[model samples]
Target: MREDTTVSALDSLYLANSIFEGKLLQAAAKYPFTVSNFFKSFDDEPLGITTSADGVLIIYWWDTLTGGTQHAYSCVAQYKTAHGIKSVSPASPNKYSCSYSKIYSLKSKDKIYYLAVYDEILSYHDRCQGIQIFLIDKDDLMPAKLIKTQTGLHSKIDYLYNDNSMRDQNWENELTYHEKTQTLTIPVALENGNLTDNYITYKFNGEYFIKLKSK
Candidate 1:
């Protein structure tokens, strides 16, 4: 995460989302797509860059907005090279999301994954307490098929919501990575006050790092 932001962390995200609104619009226009009959998908919008030994793949996130608010986030991938555009990943909405796409590579740099985890800020009371994980594939930059998680991973966003105004940073990963094991460990609090040192772990599968267990 970029810690240099003088303002709050999520505030940095919120600011980024707002600041790049124009770029988003332009990206959406560049690759027009429709998600469903009811929604216009922006899965083609390039919001991230993937650096892999295989090659550079541009990442895209389509924000489905309704009534001036984001309803869904769709991910897409584009293959790039000096000669020309080599290929394009599926226009389909993969798990592409992240305030900023942080790429984690395995033994090979080209073989990697993108991570996006965010706390549901608009949630009212505890109804919206949890961090949403959207993991994207290295090849497609689309949502990986193996893993996705929502709750039991983040400390709840409670009454202090209004007090903080910008929200809490509990959603951030308190991490431990095992090189040989290829595991990412994140310590989070339970929602119902079950445990304070609850740890959720993800093991890198062949394609993605899926949630292994929590305790």
Candidate 2:
């Protein structure tokens, strides 16, 4: 595992060629798989990787910083069997101008994955935080839905804003969906171990979002 001090430590990490190239090359040689170059341009943080149901690997390039109201681009290679390169495609092109920092390929009945993004604001003497999420189908790579809202301030001060207002703020958030119970859970925890949980049950007809609260 390689580490760098570029963006925040929360900035994702990518596997290096020297680390996984041997195993990947061995997999390609033994199995009927292809290898292609995956490329993208950004602040050079870590890259995300996940496998499809058919054993195809999907790589995601995540940008740590919110690009000043600009959208970041990602490119992925979908390999074909017989160990040959086939095609390259865009993950999210011209969708929205936000930061998708975390990507997860879900193993659920609905066959979908999720990307979590957020807008961060740091005070001179306080903590920084933000929020954004996306749900897309695994097969088509089409965005099923998106949530671009802020949470709340993360500082030492006890200042209060419009609690009922629906504007974006900065806070910690997580997204996950359960296949068996068809439930999505977003549990928020603070520094004191106080926890709040929010749940959403899905029928898989379409995409949906659930609010998370931190105690």
Instruction: List per-prediction Cα lDDT, in the order shown.
Output: 0.40, 0.35
Candidate of highest TM-score: 1
Question: Which stretches of candidate 1 lie above 4 Å from their native place?
Answer: 1-98, 107-111, 124-140, 148-181, 193-195, 205-215
Q: For candidate 1, which ten residues in a row score worst on lDDT?
A: 154-163
lDDT of 2 by residue, 1-215 (tens): 78764775323322333234344434533444333333333226355544344444443334434333342333343444343433334333233422234333444455444433322222222222222222332333344443312453211111111222222535433444455543344444344433334322222333333333333
C-alpha TM-score for every candidate = 0.38, 0.34
lDDT of each residue in 1-215, candidate 1, tens digit only: 77674776656656566555545444433443311111233234443333333434444544433212323343444443333342333332223222223334344355344333232223233212222222334323344333434543321111112213225545443445565787766665454422234577877676555678986
Give RMSD to native, each candidate: 13.8, 13.1
